[model samples]
Target chain A: MTPAPGDPAPAPGLIPRDSLLPNLEFPFRDLNSRVTPTECFYVRNHFPTPALTAGGWSLTVGGAVLHPLRLGLEELRSLPSRTVTATMECAGNGRTFLSPRPRGVPWELGAVGTARWTGVPLSAVLERAGLPEVVAAWEVVLEGADRGVMTEPVPSPGEISYARSVPLAKALDDVLLAHEMNGEALTPDHGFPVRAVVPGWYGMASVKWLTAVRVVPGPFLGYFQTVDYAYWEEKDGLPPQLRPIGPLQLKAAIARPAPREVVPCGVTYEVTGAAWSGEADVARVEVSVDGGCTWADAEFLDPPMPHVWRRWRFRWQTPEGPGSRTLLARATDTRGRTQPTCHDPARGSYMITHPLPIEVDVRESSP
Target chain B: MTPAPGDPAPAPGLIPRDSLLPNLEFPFRDLNSRVTPTECFYVRNHFPTPALTAGGWSLTVGGAVLHPLRLGLEELRSLPSRTVTATMECAGNGRTFLSPRPRGVPWELGAVGTARWTGVPLSAVLERAGLPEVVAAWEVVLEGADRGVMTEPVPSPGEISYARSVPLAKALDDVLLAHEMNGEALTPDHGFPVRAVVPGWYGMASVKWLTAVRVVPGPFLGYFQTVDYAYWEEKDGLPPQLRPIGPLQLKAAIARPAPREVVPCGVTYEVTGAAWSGEADVARVEVSVDGGCTWADAEFLDPPMPHVWRRWRFRWQTPEGPGSRTLLARATDTRGRTQPTCHDPARGSYMITHPLPIEVDVRESSP
Candidate 1:
């Protein structure tokens, strides 16, 4: 069905994991390029898309600031802008693989995509707002225009705006108030008008439908910040403390020879996939055919880039005999972090960066 | 000070993590051969080294068997023997890295060593004991001759033998009762006369100073099995369940260019380490120089083998600038399991297989 005006027109093959909140997953099997097309990029929304226009929208910056500033879309564009090629991944991208199934959107392996974001750095807006009170500021909370009553994790008091907070240091670093995705205006599903694009962090930190930025002196205890998108920080002899999830864990996902795909025996097949991390560039990607018993490095299609996924491919000579084989890919980030084989329960359903197994069948001939 | 008669004469340079229990660590920096020499192998003893001779020692196999047998060392040696080159690592090998420091042996990265073990397979002994009762058998308990009063985790009523249980499937697979290590008689510190060698499992399961083997119809609840060597098995929405630690997790350790050691800048330096896993072969090893920011595959010196560690080396051209740099290595197992970067608290003090960071100073010249 064709989407209505202002509605998200997902790419033809984009798989909708949920319909109401519009959580779409990109078809990774079709992944062949580094930058994902706008329509083909996965869409993750905490609430129904808000019908908003650039002419009426203005980002309000206040709280812990000497000067409160309201900058309209035109004013934001007039300011010096920067474009960053980054990969944004939903925190719960691989939630479907969590045992006992976590209580959240069940994403598989496609809730991640890369794009070129153009916008004024949040630091510029914060600077214009004046930060004489910054000495006491601990975090800058970004509030989205989209609002909804939270159900799971905990019931919120009436309808609340979708919001999250980032540490003051991160806000002034590479955070962007992006109005353009790729080389064009942001689409409705992709946070139209303007959105906060937080590089090297989970997508939740980059709140969509940007509205207000509040710099607070203390930690933000919002529902999304505490009840959801948080992990248990376990210490010896101490109770597991809850901490908000942040950076993306190093991860790799196999794209080609899709799960259970039957391929002809005794032929070389090009296995392709993407590897990414939150804080570090993916240094190496390895492919394993015998269920991880042995691994060979996959050639990177693109040079190492900050805040973006690297495409990698490995050529696998299909076994002479027809049988079932499990294909797996694992990535190690420059910071020496490697994808784990087992899901960490401390992370609950988020940061599913474990090496996922893809079982494929080798047949005498393609079935 | 020289050790007296029947005392453990450790090899020169073996560092003692604990003096009383004689938990010695092999100097990994001196690791240069595939088979670690007898005196150089790390020694782990719970109680005083037992002084026993082969003529006086016997292995008693009982419980849930049609034929309970007591085979002396001579009889055991008369049976068909197999020599396996395997790596035995203490479960708490890297406990020193755990934050807040869990109670146990404070080991660094030296509680592991490889050796050629010559022994009679435990499966052969179990078969001679007759397995008609195997239908109800659940686990095989291996008890050591050494006994000590337990104080940590929980207090024991009196001195008790060090005993641990292995699943029936694993006990019947590759478990060995070895009387020889590196083609020589087992040393007093290395479980004199005889010992159980549970390949592919943590060294704890091997039960040094072996005395008895008991097959039980249910899980064994020995002090070591349940209290000391257990981890919390975390499942969603459930209280963390306590489960005994089992097979070794995939791990790699940087053995050369020792931590904090200074090397001359602007020259080729060989980064060497060893990687191993419990159930699969070490498939790949990658070395990271920039605190894990980027990685290059290390060349494996040894061919892939079952139940053994693979030594790997990567030649790195030292940067011209003199500064402190962190070196790290990560390994992936054949089963697609890669070493985790962070320690999981759920594992407590056991399975410390995360990539350990080795900070080395690149100086103008060697001091």
Candidate 2:
């Protein structure tokens, strides 16, 4: 498996050796799968997987600070923490759908997951790290423990700690020093024992196996978040930047017909799937049996959970009319966002919802 | 852990000896956090962990007609599978929220999780198993390869295979013979190789390390699903029929701030956690700082996958006021079904949405 055309380019030498772009599997196609199993879960490396130890991990906060300090994991953990329900999306999510195909891993739609992140707020940690002088744009430079003396140049530089900054305001959004995911300790690949879990943002912001976060006077520019994953593009021949492709956009899918679906009609069927958004609660999901002309709301099971996908269902009794028919499902979130038609399923790798189609056979209905 | 009133009672002699309940760093507050880490994941056992050689593992699904089957792992993998997002609630999710603490493990709260399930559809497997005569009610019993034999007399008499069945309907409702979770292979404990994943239901419906599924006639009256986890609760003060709590109810919680909360004023703090339901999608989660008077819709992070819990947040600028403020969160589904303010968290030890309380300081805002 190689990088899907739409996927983000590999961070400076981040692609592993002998690693053919692994063909990713779409999560939630089966009802008994791990929502985001370790392996298949998307990997968005800033530089490369840094080798580090928990016993020696320490984060430093500097700049215009009253007192700059390096707090050990033990010390960091000793501070108060805020748990958050956040969904981390890779900036390159759904990238494999890019037109002409982007040069990246062909992610088969399995690059996202929602988790209960537990960690000290970035503000508290930064405050504890001491906010150096009052600058226009505060840049928090994160440095990892991995052996990286100077892989790139300065100003527009690259370091080990995979550092990036928030808009001061967004940076203070109670980010967590996430020590856990779901309810288990962070697995090694996902930044064992620790990672930054920022809510409502892209995965790049949530650095893994993090260490030092130094405050600078200007915007932090690194190769990972800025150069590779982030992009500007236009829709339908419009001007660029109208729909910036930096972070996660709203999306949904039919989990029932996942991977592949086949059925004999005239039988009762419950069409179901999931829907989500960056800032929207899924309001409804519509399914169409005859293309996109007619739509119906699927019965949603249980109340919606924040940071989790909303499951919806629609019961259909196929008529014993004729041959095969395509069933299409589209979801809409509370922000009045509906799944877009598959304008071009292969065009944009991420964001736009690709109409999920299920092919079924028509049979005689039971009396 | 002993089976309390609300907890699902495993078979007699099923409780483990070294079953000292492990202490969690955080208190039981949210529906998702109730999930135990690998070490703490609740194990509802009917028999002890089995002993078998992978060398001899074989599954046979053939009876009356056409394509009778006996397939090994390799043979099964040759077939395609569908994936789905579903929540597996312990039939006794709210058992721990019972009155005077029920007679079980005294589970702190309803423990549940949502994951992406992958496997061949049960309908396909049944298609291979060949459709036997359709009975009135129907029973599609599934059993594991583990050791254990029920001594109870067969109530139905015509027991075709050691299996249970639902209305030939449920079997067609996207049941899966899942081999993967999220995107990785299933863990041995959860159910390796293969298992049945029934969406919109409790954990028991999913038979692990599945051995066989015989479509018998009539309803399933297995000890674990029916006699043990199911209950008769006084709904509106009436003890209805001793029916199994089929679907889940609205539930929400604050991951932290349990027992009590003590914090300095003006320090921007975050109140977050998970919420879920078995019956409908949670529409809105309202948090109250002044007990139950003032309600504010907290920020919720919707999951990219469906039927999972959404992580939610409510950021408040600590007021210049001072007093003991209790923090409580509740949920409502698309059907306008909001979690009740009921103090008792358990509904028949199965579904509980009891309001959780927390005390916080309202010191002046940080300078």
Candidate 3:
């Protein structure tokens, strides 16, 4: 669907921009959004879109399995389960926000989305596979039911298993085998049926459309798991350091109905967006109508939860008289982690978690 | 094909050690290389691969034109063209080599590749389209036959097309709308039939599976062109710089076998590799046999051409005695640019070009 007039399409339609193209297109915006809408969710697809059907689907447990068995959706549902609301942001969400110019995907703002996931603990599936009763690192491979699966392992060291391993600890967290989202069955677009919910890790580790689970020793070095998300750093003659899966970093985004929306003369408005972190719960989310010179506490929609997003909203009365106005949103996660004031927009590695400043086209009120 | 047992796989195979998975998969080399075979080339699909039949495919030129024209493969073949054996590095090629950890598409070393891209001069196509008569500053957009086409009025102020644009001047260079590769019809994997060969620019500017050309005003920010390959630095302490067509920075790769090759004792060997630069030609490529202590000028293949790779070969006289040896290759491009020593694995903004120190496994030959 085409967006009317000069409006950027919300999630489900927003495609991160690529920098290398010859011409510039689109009127892009970086919404320091409070709540990332579904349609506006940023997407990062590795291969061709796999057309999966739920009717004949089953989650299979393989690899070091004593009894490799395929459990139908019904069977998976029969297993003990739980539910949790969490947010998942692509590591490259705010990539374009980086400086020194990070490589790979050129994300303008950040691509983040929150949803309620329902699934069984990854440990449950692995247990059914039977323990190897051995000592060593076995990577938990998650294979998607797609044609690309054939050539998948060919690309990575492990035969293309759509898998990522969690240490024996994280996999057993009463983490749900999410099948329902926000009280609705998982939509095909959002990995229907089941997907892993390994809280505190980057979204990539929470494999969408989770299928099989295995207990691999050592590290989960699936191409996407180990190879892709890893980062190697060499600053000033120091040895390079590689960052594997760790808790999410603190970040905030401001999103609203208005793109410089002109509020009626003297009309009041609300400043809102989302704040989250894999590190810790958010303590407070703040908004600055005066470009961060002053901060106002934005009410959190709900008490913060671990690895879950905290929605913050602040209501403000537009100045009785106005020419134009601009506002910003910033949040402070629980661990004394405040939302960044400005996205670094680094070019070399793609991490640009900048606070957003937006222009508001305010109209003067007539008496 | 699987590599021989004793021989290491091009990339992520086990490193014949007690450990199964190596600490790091893609080892850093001064020259960027994909460890996998051609089949394992990291597929950076900006858009779905365009499916064009070689039987009878034509390119359509429209949008701001005297008359919409369709040129068949034959017509494009009939046009005068040129070909160059250049290396196309994704502007984001070295993301795996970054620090402070940026975000976005997690691309490995494979994002860079060397191919004999063939194409007709885009300027010739514009002539056939009758430019000057059509539009000015009027950018041209290239749309692929693939369903994924950028929305109209490219997101950029330039209003370029879904494909990147070539300034009117550069488009007219001896650019090729190549029909053959290494003297063979284009392979589908290599954009068979037709594609642009934008010299000195990042791979994104050279749209694959060329189909539609729409000339308009402004930069063409298509999904492939703009949304995915850009870098922005809007941070507090930063200087403004003109964005160029993302060009491949100076890069070099070891062409000779890695240092790990087992060499019979007391045997002299040759150290070799290739170097390239996008902005300028390579001036000098040096080889350091003694681990960067002493340097020697490696022989550079002659008539160094822009957009073409220059091969450098250095003959090394192995010590007559017996012991494991270390071999190294360092290349400098034409612009007096020298390869940086491997100080840190994650080097620059996606351009991790550095001097390589190859390790050789030596076995003494007994009398």
Model 1: docking quality category? incorrect
- What overall lDDT goes with each candidate model? 0.81, 0.56, 0.56
TM-score of each: 0.49, 0.41, 0.44
Q: At residue A348, what lDDT does model 1 achieve? A: 64
What are the per-residue Cα lDDT tens digits for candidate 1 across A57-144? 9888987888988999999999999999999899998787677886788887889999999999999999988886454337888989
RMSD of each: 27.0, 28.4, 25.2
Model 2: lDDT equals: 0.56
For every prediction, compared with the true complex, DockQ reads 0.01, 0.00, 0.01
lDDT of 1 at B46: 79
Question: Could you arrange the candidates by TM-score from highest to lowest?
Answer: 1, 3, 2
Best DockQ among the predictions, by candidate number = 3
Report the C-alpha lDDT of model 2 over B1-367, residue by residue, as the tens digit: 1111111222221123225322121123322332233333445544445544455656666433256677787667668888887766665544444566644444454345666788888787787777866644555666676545432211111221122234457776667888887777776666667878877667767777777665644334443433234543322211122244455666676654443445446545666667777657777888887788888898776642345566676775555466677888888777887766664322334555677665665445344
Superposed by TM-score, candidate 2 places the C-alpha of residue B293 at a distance from the truth, in angstroms, of: 85
Q: What CAPRI grade goes to candidate 3?
A: incorrect
